[model samples]
Target: MSPTRSHDGLDIGVSFEFFPPKTEKMEETLWASIKRLAPLSPRFVSVTYGAGGSTRERTHNTVARMLRETPLKPAAHLTCVDASREEVDDVISDYWMIGVRHIVALRGDPANGVGQRYQPHPEGYASTPELIEGIRKIGDFEVSVSAYPEKHPESPDVVADIELLKRKVDAGATRAITQFFFDNDVFERYVERVRKAGIDIPIVPGLVPVVNFSQTAQFARRAGASVPAWIVKRFEGLEDDVETRKLVAAAVAAEQAFDLVDRGFRDFHFYTMNRADLVFAICHLLGLRAKPEEVAKATAAA
Candidate 1:
């Protein structure tokens, strides 16, 4: 992908992903980060469901709170792992009743954990496409499904991955958020392939600001994302330097976002890891700012 110098006065769309907090202190931190990023007016924010639907209640509570207390649209993540159809349908109904119109449907990892073979419950929706269809039947939800630019770990090839995405789109998924990747060319090529396969939904690239390089690298390996050699070199010798690591993280993320923008991508999804500092810095670099007027209006409404 050749980068273009078209950085002057561009408006872009962004969405954020957050995981439900597991404790009171983490809850406080999550809320603080949400309040900070809320002012920038993301297109939508999503809260993740834990593996095997373990954090179902926590995820629901977080989404409900966002709906009630903030002026932001929240997308609840629903997974088809160890859940019966009726149970998952009930969750979908509950979200609909609470005014949630968007859902991120996923085929969650095996209940045993990552790297384990995923076995769908006997009475559950077997895949993400089935989950999307179930949500549509429950209500008119704007569903989003997962995409893997480098191909899902379990997928045999890119063709199989795109076929799955096509099924989800046909089942009513309107958007696909990809797994985070370090290489822009890989994403660009994936986008082209998705389009050529007749899947027209938005394939938003997911960006992760490396809060902890080692941890992020581990996650990348598990999720089938490649960690470019250059990224490893960038974080080299900063093992104990917290402040400088953060600075490098912000710079690297900013460069990636800007390069994607130059390639004509106007929408992005950020995996925030429940923190806002690095994401906020990258958003600023992408020309997104918190409009004071909008903030004041939201505050007054609250």
Candidate 2:
């Protein structure tokens, strides 16, 4: 049997993504989500960086706090958008100094917003590949890069996107977490193409638990991903019906994941959007479980 096929024939590894919160309430909520999901023993959790270093301080603080507070390994996102080489390196060094060994390096989208043209800082790393090389030069940080299974919007073709990923791997990226897609076939084909091109880094499929139709649609637009019409129809008319939406969201996401697992995908990275309920539910469906005592603690707190 393939390594991905388990005794129960279900692929098992999972990870999560989180963004630094902007307020006290948001911070509390974020920690709650973290505490709830931590019991699942994710491979590692990532903290996202803001545009143009807007949340640089917040990202740093959140990551540092996570390092000090939890057993969960934290991966900090670093981008070559507005910071100079010296500035970016200083940030990387700070992460290393603080014992954060994993980094998600990217040539971030334009700070103005997606669809706006992206221009690297005149004195900074020019692309994700360059950023990966810089990260490797600075330290032995295990780096992750962004992959768009459907093709990045900036790239004229999927081939271009795959070539860029090849360069990222060649430049020392340890893994590539894809931009989320609704269809599992997209990921399977993308992985096949990556392997065919001789790139061997793990390409983890990014899973976004659909929490809200409007919000997910907006995010998908910003991230250069397509939301299929079928997905839209599935969530239709549940706008105010929160409970039903949650149920449907969980089912949709779980089914997508199950298909991937059946196809031999072993690792998944969830973009939780700092919401616990749906992600937790999907993880449960995938056979994730917290220790009894841990569940009791969370339940008592709840």
Candidate 3:
């Protein structure tokens, strides 16, 4: 049997990723997405920080609100980019004070943009490994780091990518979340390589429901993830058909999640892009259910 096949009765746990909104409209959309997905009993939810700490205040405030208002455990993304060690440390301390125990540590991209030279701040943590170490020193955070299934664009090869992950694990990353990929084989092969390296961290596959194929295509190019030619063909000429596109998006994502679950991956991290209906439908198809507490709350609200 393929390793991907589901084993005995293990419950699948899901988590979601949302970016901090920059406008009131976006804020409304973000909260709508959160509330829509909240009833599914995700293991946690995360708010992403922008490149070079651009969303620092918003990220902190959003995460703080989640702690105060929601049952979801909020993981805040922290990066060592364009900031001093002291500045980064202050941010970490702020998160800790707000009762956050999880962080996604990253060596952020250049503020100028991708393909530009990356220069670490002389006083800040350099790479993700260094960031992980710094986080561990400050608090017992359940630190998760990024993994590139197709290998980081800056990496010379897959071997180098695996080695980098090992270094982060050694430095105290509790888990690894991969960049989104359409091909499950990429994830499967990456996991195989990760296990062979003797690093036993849970590598959760990140799922992006392709609501807008063109936007996702552009993003995949920027992030160095490949969008298979066949996938484009699947959504070909549907640009003007928003409803049909959404239906297709849900079906594709649902199939991918079901296949992963069958393969024994019980954890998934969805990149929601602040859209709720599609991701919510996909999670429902994955057998996720609201706990009684959440259902009661939803019922009361209704």
- Judging by TM-score, tell me the better candidate of 1 and 2: 1
Against the reference, the lDDT scores of all candidates come to 0.90, 0.87, 0.87
- Which of candidates 2 and 3 reaches a greater TM-score? 3
The residue pairs that clash in candidate 1, if any, are none
Candidate 2 Cα misplacement greater than 4 A, ranges: 1-11, 52-54, 292-302
Q: What TM-score, to 2 decimals, does candidate 3 have? A: 0.94
Give the C-alpha lDDT of model 2. 0.87
Candidate 1 residue-wise lDDT, 1-302, digit = tens: 01112246666888999999999999988987887788778899999996545499999999998988888899999999888999999999999999999999999999888899999999999999889989988898999999999999999999999999999999999999999999999999999999999999999999999989999999999999999999999999999999999999999999999899889998889999999999989988887878776577456544
Candidate 2 colliding pairs, count: 0
Alpha carbon deviation, residue 107, candidate 3 (Å): 0.5
- Model 1 / residue 73 / CA error / Å: 0.0
Backbone Cα, N, C clashes tallied per candidate? 0, 0, 5
Residue 100 error, candidate 3, Å: 0.3
Sorted by lDDT (best first), the order is 1, 2, 3
Give me the runs in candidate 1 sitting further than 4 Å from their true place: 1-7, 51-54, 297-302
Residue pairs with backbone overlap in model 3:
4-262, 4-263, 5-262, 5-263, 6-262
Please give the range of 10 consecutive residues that has the lowest summed lDDT in model 1. Answer: 1-10
Q: State residue 281's C-alpha deviation in candidate 2, in Å.
A: 0.5
Cα RMSDs, all models: 3.6, 3.1, 3.6
